[model samples]
Target: MRWITSISYKNGDGEVALAFAPEIAQFLVQLKKHFTSYQLSKAAALRSTYSWRLFENLERFRETGIWEVDMDRFHTIMETPKSYRRNFNDARRFVIDPALAELAAKTNITAQVEPIRRGRKIDRLRFTFENASQMKLAL
Candidate 1:
């Protein structure tokens, strides 16, 4: 099913209108009522899929400022390649670093990821994030 079914322009005024599928319209209305516009705008502005996904996951922990995920889950969520999935250096260099950089540059979030070691190998990741909006409220 498509989200946007049609688009049109108004006569003379040159205004544009979008016609969304019913499910999409309902979902958008709900999002508008319940979600913050700032967060939505930030998500829209992000260029990397990794950055966008990371932003979404971190927003849930804005109040707590921390998120921990198993390496396997992180790999699944970020869709890292087989090579990168097992290699922490490659994953961090190719996936994590770029995503974090984009998020810092494009959004008001500052985040850092630290790998947790289990025995001799990395097993999990701990993410600490601070949102500018949250910081302003705290100040």
Candidate 2:
């Protein structure tokens, strides 16, 4: 689904305008009713693109509280290039760790990564997180 249909901007005066398809509005309203949503402020505070992407992906699974993603699929979702695919440790160090750290510090959720290993090689990553707001309410 396309989030934006058209955009207009003024060169000298810095005026900007956006036009969305009528269908998008309906879709957004339905999405709010059917799926979990995140705070725009929190999303904006994320320092890296990876952090923002991971947060959105995790937020969708908030009801389940856990998400298991295969390394290949995760890399695809994160748009990692071929060079980074060969080194899981480097990828985790440069991408996943920083993103998860920023996410934990700046957002109302916390996540832990559990690597699933296959005979000395890591295959998948299991992510577990809890909604802090819900946890507080439970207490």
**Residue 115 local lDDT, model 2:** 87
- For each candidate, what TM-score against the reference? 0.68, 0.69
Each model's lDDT: 0.85, 0.84
What is the per-residue lDDT of model 2 for residues 1-139, given as tens digits with 9 covering 90 to 100? 6778989999998998877788887776677678667778767878888998899989889889898999899899888877768898888898889988888777877998898998888899999998787322222
Instruction: Give every collision pair in model 1.
Output: none
Model 1, global lDDT: 0.85
